[model samples]
Target: MNPAEGAGSLSAAVQAGLEGTGLASLSAGVRRLMDAYRSGEVPAAPVLTSAREVAAYAAYRMPATAAATGAAFAQMRRGLPGWTPATVLDFGAGTGGASWAVADQLPDAAGLTLLEQSGEAIRLGQAILAESTSGALRGAAWRRWRLELSDAAERAAVQDSADLAVAAYVLGELTERQQDRLTELVTGAAPAVLLLEPGTPAGHRRILAARARLLAAGYDVVAPCPHQLGCPLEVPGDWCHFAARLQRSATHRRVKGADLPYEDEKFSYVAAARPGVGSPDCPAGRVVRRPGQRKNLVTLDLCDRDGRATKLAVGKSKGEAYRRARKTSWGDRWDDAATG
Candidate 1:
């Protein structure tokens, strides 16, 4: 499905979940949730404690989450064309935003499992997904599993094998040890893994760390990074991130008390797959920043397969290369062939 259709479907599903709910209470809950997220401290308990909070979260944050997740999935598809996972496992899935993204991006994913600690989130997720037309989403299994579990057997039982595993906007909520454990669990369960975090220095650091672990575990880099070597942006105060712009609905605006018709969800992500599972046709370079244009020249900042970050200027003299550069946006794959 196209982005507009996917957004419309998600908005409809959220509205279905919020039917008969009080908008005043939901708006207040959204403010509280936003404050909690901005505080940068993991709450002592599940954030979606009450049914109202879950609804508030679904109405407020789910769209942006879906947008960001979809952007990451698009990059993954570019890296591995024609690859589709039959099964998907989402860790800390919350109200299933990532699942919705998968349905839109990889429609052939037949089986989906969503693991979350909040009972309210699980129930609300089920309700939201039930409104979806996609059979894969409607048939998804919502399991209440805590990532902090210490028992090996309990952890193993919850770690069902799948073709792709996702942990989106949840890693920062765990302790260092818990993060390590969750990484190991997901890596063991799936041949491919996708990790997403807020587009902040800390978030980029988490993704970098996770990328290192995946590489050590014999996984190959798939998206965002063009090479398996160390990230060149690892220098202090410099980090890699991208933005996904999403149009906001009327209800979304009311819940967030914002007047903007759209918002850009900045996020950092890493997609990697086990050696043989990754594509050999990964792009030679990825546009790392917004392209700068002036007169007849367009300049691009890219992370290339050579494991280096560099800038290239395409001018009108370059003919087709200049046309391609003019149309390229941030987070797009850049091919050297375009210049040749």
Candidate 2:
């Protein structure tokens, strides 16, 4: 995948829906609410409260979140090329951004079950779906249900879960133990599970814990990791992350107080296939960091199929592979074909 992908440009229909919501004046206030969320001030409550907060979060975070998640989906595609998911179960589906991303990846997605604690977010999601042109998304079940790590009833209700499940940016709020429990809950709910978090030490830590549990449960990693081996980059001040850039609209700029035309969403994610699923075919390895290009050679750091890091230097004299290395960006699946 490109280090930066364009996946979540706001649709005209969505923009029009927001306009019809008559909540345009609340954008600035919602931006402040987002600031609170970033600071972790709004812990133990819904990040989105009123309709305006929902609109603000949808405008300010949806595009970047969708773009990042879409990149992760692309990686999953590379890993599990033959698997096709017909249904999606979204936990903590705020504004339904991740659900929309799922529909984008699988146009044939026939069922969507979204459970969120915030009624406000669910309402806004309904509005967005009402204006959607996709038949699959047009008919969705977005509900207001609290997702507790210890709620057996909730887990039981998800027993009749879908083929794919996603939990995006919602795990950082829990304790490590709760995160571990939630991992089992998520995997139990679907055959394929995707967990994404912000690109931070805390976020990466949560993903690492989830990865350990998924592996312990005999799950095979589909993307990001070439093999089921333990992550080798355990050094301090370093965390595995990928980046995706999305175009921001004028309303998005005003809500977030930004002047840049585009923003890069840095994220850490893990995508795993369940027990019956087979291991992914890794022709070479995955690009763990951005490739560095210089005069006569390019330096590529790869996490090989066994999940160990190897740094390779390819000079121009090496031929076509070297030429292709120059174009290999971050978050890409590099193979022997590119390693002459």
Candidate number achieving the greatest lDDT relative to the actual structure: 1
TM-score of each: 0.95, 0.91
Model 2, residue 36: displacement in angstroms? Answer: 2.5
RMSD of each: 2.1, 3.3
What is the RMSD of candidate 2?
3.3
In model 2, the runs with Cα more than 4 Å from the true position are: 1-9, 20-24, 40-42
- List the global CA lDDT of all models: 0.87, 0.78
Cα lDDT tens digits, model 1, 183-202, are 88888889889999999888
lDDT at position 39, candidate 1: 89
Off by over 4 Å in 1: 1-8, 158-160
| Tens-digit lDDT track of model 2 for 1-340 | 2222223334443465477554456566565766765784226655677777778778778777778888998888778767788899988888888888778778788899888888888887887766666677779898777757678787888874889889988787666666777787888888899999988767777888899888888788887888888887656988888888787776667766789978889899999987565445655787878889899888888888877888988899989988888888788988877788
